[model samples]
Each structure stands twice: as C-alpha cells, then as structure tokens.
Target: MHLPKNAHVALVDGENFVVMRNGGAPLEPKLDRSEKPDLSASNYSAGVKHQDDAGQALGRTDLEELAHGAAAAAWLNAKAVAGEIDDILVIADPKTLGEMRRHYHTELEKRLVGEIAKTLTGEPTKRIEQIIADA
Candidate 1:
C-alpha cells in the first residue's frame, strides 16, 4: 500500500476531523465544524417513550452525528474539486465512515485511495503516519 506523494488524509470521528498531506506535516483542517444535536427532536423530548417488554427504545438516531459526517464529506468534495487534494485517505469509525461513503460526490469518490475503519481523530500526527505506514 504505497501512498501517493501528496495524498491527503483525514482523521475523522462524529464530532471532529484532522487533515494531513502525506509528504508534509499534519495540519488543521481548512474546514472544521461541530454541531449540536437538535434538542427539539422527538428523541430528546419528554414524552412517554415507547418500549418493548425489555424497556428498550425501538431505535436511536443522532442529528449531531449526521451533521459531522455531512460536513466532512462536503469539505472533502470541495477540496477535491478545487484541486487542493488529488488522492485521499479516510480514517473514521465504522458508522461515520458509512455516512461519509453515503454522502461522497462522484468526483471525490474517484479520489479515494484508502479507508480505515477506525477512529483516529485524537491521535498525534506521528502516530497516524505510523499507523498508515503499518496498514
């Protein structure tokens, strides 16, 4: 798995992202965003919640999680189209990675070099590089 000389990598999670270029030091993302879940959503409301005999909610959804994935995908799309990045490596947790895959534009999809299903947003750059190298 040889990395392209100037390939870009993004370490992403539900709430944050850190972008880096392969041949250079890691840098702060040009576009960084964090979103709070909508408190008005039914899930957060004080209603008699439905539950099975086991007292489990039928399902769960998070707006903040969705927002983070969308923002990251949008940023990647913009950078790829602007020629700021040619190749891309994405490191994210399984769910966020799935969301990113769902939201990626065709152009950005073509630029994807690799996807690592692991959360690395809080990792230092040196550790990230080593992980990429090891992978």
Candidate 2:
C-alpha cells in the first residue's frame, strides 16, 4: 500500500541523537542519520545506527541521549506535519514508548525495532505493518 505523501516520519535514534545533541549540530540542518555524528560503527543488527539508543547498552542513559532522541523525533514530527515526509516511524526502544509518547504525543506511534531501541526496552519489537495498522 502506498503511504500518504508528506507522511509524518518519526525517526528515532537514541545514540546518534544524544551524540548530535551533545556534539552540537541541531541547527546544522542535515539528515538525522548523518555520518558526521556517528560514535562508531556499531555491529548492530542492521548496521543502521540511528535507531540505537546512545547510552542504553551501559545500563545508564544520559539526558543528552534522551533529549537528542526526542529532538530528532520531534524534528521528524514537525517536518512531517509540514508535509515534508510521508509517515513517522520511531526507531527507538519500545520501553521508551511512554517517554516517546510523552515527548512526542503528536506522533502517530513509537515502536522498538532495532538493537538500540531494543536494548533500551529489552523487549521484542512489533511489526511495522502491524503498528501502522493499529494506528
């Protein structure tokens, strides 16, 4: 099925978000997953690092990560709302569902799918189709 053009895409990445947030580039205006803020090439499930929570692996998370992730998600939300995207797909931990929801209640949904979002919540992720269907 084709998604609506200018869909709200809520892309999430705990690690990169935190890095960029702390690293200082929120106003640089680039893709959220730009390689400039990569902490390192994490051998994650997909090698797609943006979805990973920057500090979830160490049992301790920083406000920077949380804020960064939320910021990224919010950016997507704003962009989507402005008709810049077609849909919003949160790529962080489902455990952060409540946090994500609280942070970005405007988003249609937040789901845990990748290693970082998974690691944060330590829970299995639901299917994207299923999530969209539910939404």
Candidate 3:
C-alpha cells in the first residue's frame, strides 16, 4: 500500500518502539527507544503482587508488557494531538496492536489510517517501507 506523504509510522513491540516519518528523505526516527530502559518481567514484578480482589494469583507478565506498549501508544497519541503528525500507521504484533487499540485516545483513534499486524520493531527502515508499500 502506498502511504500518504509525511504519514507517521509507529513500529512497536512490548519492549521498545520507534516513530518514523515517511517523506522525501529516508524514514527518520522522530521518537526512538532511547527514552525507556529495556525492562524485564522481573523488573516490573518486583514488589508488585499479582493477585485479584479475591487473592487469586493472576498472570501479570503479559499485562505488564501490554501496559508498556500502551504507554508508547500514548506518546504517539500526544504527538498526534499536538499536530506533529498528520496520519498514523501502526505496525506491531497482534498482542501489542490489541493493547494499542485498547489504550488509544479518541483523537488518536481518529487519526489512525492503517495497521499491519506483525512484529517489525527491529526491521530496517527500508525493509519496513518496502513491506508496507507492497502490502
């Protein structure tokens, strides 16, 4: 698919995310993973009890990772709201995409134009652009 000129593409996964602007110049990273540390399950679980109101043990690993992904989505949302981006194309794994959908603000939801349900966080910019263009 041909992306709109200057469309913002957000490549995200549970651990990291990067926002790229598609333009005459090569895809340049607007926001990168440098802001957040690479966190492990142990880091998020330390001192945090994984239980429900009934004290039943609950799985928090995925949930914690989802929250991190949502946080990355929120950052993109803020940028969109600020008019820093015109449109959005989200490329992420199914789970991260679901989390992004769940946590998106109303304004950001309206700005979304495309989605690719695959993990491409570590893919090179040219490769990602080719994949999207061919999609």
Candidate 4:
C-alpha cells in the first residue's frame, strides 16, 4: 500500500515496543511495559499450595513479559482502526521482522488486519523521520 498523504510516525522503544502513526503523531510517547508478573518462588508456591490449580501459575515472568509485548504492538493498530490512514507497519525486533518476510507465503494468506505494505524495521524511533527520505 502507498504511504498515507499525511505524515506518519513509526515509533519504537528501548523495552522492545512498536507503534505506527499516520495523519498525526502518536500521542503515547513513553512505552509502558512495566506491568509484569512477579515470579518469585513464594508467589508461585502460594497459589499452588492453596488452590492446587492456579493454571499457569507455574509460568515464569519472562514468558509473560514477552507475550505482553506482542499484545501491546497489536493494540496500537487497534487504536487506529477509525482513521483514514492507509495502515501501519510494526516490527518488534530483527528476528520477528525477518520472520515476517521469510514466511511471507503463510503470513500473506492470513495476515491483513494491520499494515499492508512492506516496511523497514529496527527501531522506528530513529527511522521515523527518515520515512520521508526513504519514500
């Protein structure tokens, strides 16, 4: 898809965040991935000991954090559904970004909700301004 006529911003953060903007800059500046699950031994054992079935209580905090990160990227696009913007291209990391391109055959058949055009990844923060030059 063609880039929107309106200037767009693709934002990325140090905590591994991805967001896109068109028609207007993103209002959310700081990435908020601070909400993480506490995976202390005491915390995990407490629920298992009492309920014996906390389901997923055995999971580690790192796993939960990564899942939240992916969800956060999806949420940004959901917020933009009403706008006239073409679409956004959000990339979490080099690996996922590469994966998206490599599995294009499979992804193309199923993925269409978010950005439509192929996009450059790796920290949208630095490249946000360069989009115009690149385009």
TM-score of every prediction relative to native? 0.71, 0.39, 0.71, 0.34
Query: What value does the lDDT take at residue 22 in candidate 3?
Result: 68
Worst 10 residues of 4 by lDDT: 38-47
Between 1 and 4, whose lDDT is larger? 1
Once fitted onto the true fold, the runs of candidate 3 whose alpha carbons sit more than 4 angstroms away are: 24-61
The local distance difference test score of model 1 is: 0.67
> Over the stretch 66-128, how does candidate 4's per-residue lDDT look in tens digits?
333334433433434534223444433443333233323332323232332334445344454
- Model 2: per-residue Cα lDDT over 6-78, one tens digit each: 2322334455432111111222212222222223322232222334475456655545555555555455456
Cα RMSD, each candidate: 7.5, 13.4, 6.2, 11.5
Give a tens-digit lDDT track for model 1, residues 1-135: 456766777777777777766664333222222222222122222112322434334334454665577678878888788877788888998877877787788889889988999988777666777777767
lDDT of 3 by residue, 38-101 (tens): 4333333222343344432544346566666667777877777888767888899887787778
Model 1 CA deviation exceeding 4 Å by range: 24-60
lDDT-sorted candidate list, best first: 3, 1, 2, 4
Candidate 2 wrong stretches, greater than 4 Å: 1-11, 17-59, 95-98, 105-135
Which 10-residue window of candidate 1 scores lowest in summed lDDT?
38-47
Q: Cα lDDT for residue 73, model 1?
A: 80
